[model samples]
Each structure stands twice: as structure tokens, then as C-alpha cells.
Target: MTANTSKSTEGAHEPGGFGALRRLHLSYAGEVQGVGFRWASKLTAERVGCTGWVRNEPDGTVTQELQGTPDQIATYFGAFSRVFAAHPIEYVIAEKSDISPIEDERLFTVRF
Candidate 1:
């Protein structure tokens, strides 16, 4: 999919203000399926206070939509990267781009 870098003003008036809040649609390829990647993502999202959903695609990739403050998302990725470094599974961010944050999204989930 093509990347869209446009920013959204949907969350600008929220409690913590805007610009810092971000939502991203991401597709991960490689040894991502059946490798605990979704669980890791769920845990990381929780740890970083993010709200999103992750699922495995039929094409042997993983897709996730993550939402949080910029810092939180960074921290989530940093932690996930560390996990990857310790494991044999390799992954690439096949696609990632800004998306509109969902209002009242309170929890991260793993889709079956």
C-alpha cells in the first residue's frame, strides 16, 4: 500500500492536546506469523499505553493499526526491536503510515 504522511486534526482537541497523538497502519513481513509477534505487540501496546489491533494475514505477514502518543509508539517499537534482537525471527516493516486515531479506543487486541 502507498504511504500517506498527511496528519489529521481529529484528536487535536483532546485532553493532552494534538500533534503528539498519532495513529499508524503497519504491515510487517518476514517470520512474523506464529512467532508470538501478535502477543508481543499486545503486551508492548499495553506497556506503552497504546490502543490498536494486530492480526495475521493470509499472505504470511502481520498487520497492525497502532495508536498512541508519539513517544509511546516509539517506546513500543524500541521494546519490540529489543525482543527481535534476542530472537531468531526477523521482520520488516513492509508498510507504515499515519492514520486517523480512533476515538475512545481503550484497548489493544489480537485478532483471530
Candidate 2:
């Protein structure tokens, strides 16, 4: 499915139901810590109607698990890339997970 590639100007809201869910496990390598990555993700996720959590990994890499419709997920990804690029960073490796049928949730949060 084609994902929304636009930057969010509206408040993100779930599209409802569990249809074509995309669960993504994103990993940012190189200088990802102590740069407010999690906060940016949480904010952007809300703008994209995403449900999940973003947090810092113990291994220095930033990690986040996102669950939502494929389109909304796409927008979330776009927002992440925009936010990541907006701030100076080393490198980002956003890896999509093999998980399927993501749970339907209405909020995105920052994991402590």
C-alpha cells in the first residue's frame, strides 16, 4: 500500500480497526543517544496517528516499536525521517520488523 508521504499539519488520529497493520522496529545507529530522539519520535508519532513507544536502548542505539495502519505508519516513518534529519545525527537505520497484524492502539508514547 502507498503510504502518506506528507508532513503532518493535522493532529494524528487512528484510522480505526486492525487492517493492514504495520509493526516497525526502528533502530538508529551512531550518535543517536542524548539527542532527544525519543521525544521527537513521540511527538511526531502523535502527529501521524501512530500507536506505540519510542525509547533509548541500553546499547546506545535508539529503538522504537510502532503499531498502526500501514498508511499511518508510513506517515510516522516520514515524520521520523524529517525529525531525524532536522536534528544533526550520525546515521539512522530504520528496520521494518517481520511482525504482522499489529495491535490497534490510539496513542504513541515515550518509553522510560
Candidate 3:
């Protein structure tokens, strides 16, 4: 995982700190690659002030883990869903895991 610095967005919710961080590891399937998904996700995470990582999986799914406050994290996921809906790129199958908090994360970026 890498650290990125981003300015908070207007009305953007953020977690307090490591203790407040909530984690969500998701598997995104269905035409998830080669469509700037990671880039778009970076923007999404930044908007909601989530700290974690999102990367492409070998199984053609976009994998991401996010840590943040409950509200902020949920807002992030909601925006993410809305983005996919508006973009309408192929299929946007996805599965999410439990939420957990993580420390030492600063910004969101596309992981290699």
C-alpha cells in the first residue's frame, strides 16, 4: 500500500484516525478492467477520505480495501455504486467483506 495526500472535499466525510478507520475489501467483476476503474476509484476514495488501496485482480476483478468511519465508508461505497451506474461499463459485479480500521494510510492511488 502507498500513501497519498488529498484535500478534503466539500461535505466529504472522514474518519477520525486509525481507530476510527473501517475496512472494506471488495471484489469487482464484469468488465472491470481497462476502463479507468482504478483511477475513478482513487477519486472516489479521495472524495470520501478513505485510507486503503484498490488494485486489479488476476481474476478480472477490481480488489479494494477501504478504511474509514462508518458513514464516510458507506458514502464512499454509495458514490462508487452510483459512479458505476452512471458510467455503465459492461458488467459491474462485486462482493464486499467486513469493515475494519487501518492506520498509516494517507491517500488513495492505483496500486501496481
Candidate 4:
């Protein structure tokens, strides 16, 4: 896990200020690829006001790097998990790592 060096004073609940932002690297395995996981993750991140990217790995995993407040990040994950559960996509959290937050992120996107 990288150190949290965010200097922004914006609170997590604030509209534009990503208060106490953090970055997370997450990988999902087991039927994650080709299951609309990346698209669903992108939607969840956008809805939660997170900035980062998700992609499909060649090893049949779905990998994503997301940046947001702790609560927002949790919410994003919850949303994704709910979708997976409802649809039964065989998704499993394989790994997670905390990373240094990028200071100037403006939007969440999906990377191919």
C-alpha cells in the first residue's frame, strides 16, 4: 500500500473535492472476463464519482485501478458485487492493493 499524500482539502461528500482520496488496484478472477465486468465497473465508478480505469486482462481476469474516498470506493465495489451476485457471473476478488492517489484525475474511464 502506498502512503496517502493527498493535499486536497475537499471532503469526501463534497461534489468536486475528492476528500481524503485513495487509489486501489483490484483484480477479479474466475469468469470475470467476457462478462461485462469492465463495463459494469466503469458505470459503478462513474456513479460513485471515482476516477480511474478498468480493463480485461489476457489471463481471464478483470483488473481495475480506482481512485476515490474510502466510502466512495466501498460503494463502487458494493455496486459491482451486487450486479455480479444478481447475474451470477462467477466473479471473485483475487487481489487488492492500495496505491498512491493521483492528484489531478478528472474522470473515470475504461481502458482496453
Every candidate's lDDT:
0.80, 0.67, 0.69, 0.75
Better candidate number, 1 or 3, judged by lDDT:
1
- Which ranking of candidates, highest TM-score first? 1, 4, 3, 2
What is the per-residue lDDT of model 1 for residues 49-82, given as tens digits with 9 covering 90 to 100? 9999999999998999999887788798888777
Residue 2, candidate 3: C-alpha displacement in angstroms = 30
TM-score of every candidate = 0.81, 0.70, 0.71, 0.79
Provide the RMSD of all predictions against the true structure, rounded to 1 decimal. Answer: 4.5, 8.2, 9.5, 7.2
For TM-score, candidate 1 versus 4, the one ahead is 1
- The sequence of per-residue lDDT tens digits that candidate 4 reaches over residues 1-24 is 122222333322334454677877
After superposition, which runs of candidate 1 have C-alpha atoms over 4 Å from their true positions?
1-19
TM-score, candidate number 1: 0.81
Candidate 1 local Cα displacement, residue 82, angstroms: 1.1
| Candidate 3 vs 4: which has more lDDT | 4
Give the poorly placed runs of model 2, Cα more than 4 Å off. Answer: 1-19, 84-86, 101-104
lDDT tens digits, residue span 25-92, model 3: 66677777898888878899899888788899887888887777777876886887677675677654
Model 3, position 105, has a per-residue lDDT of 74
The residue-by-residue lDDT of candidate 2 on 40-87, one tens digit each, is 888888887778888887888777778777678768767767775555
Candidate 4 off by > 4 Å:
1-18
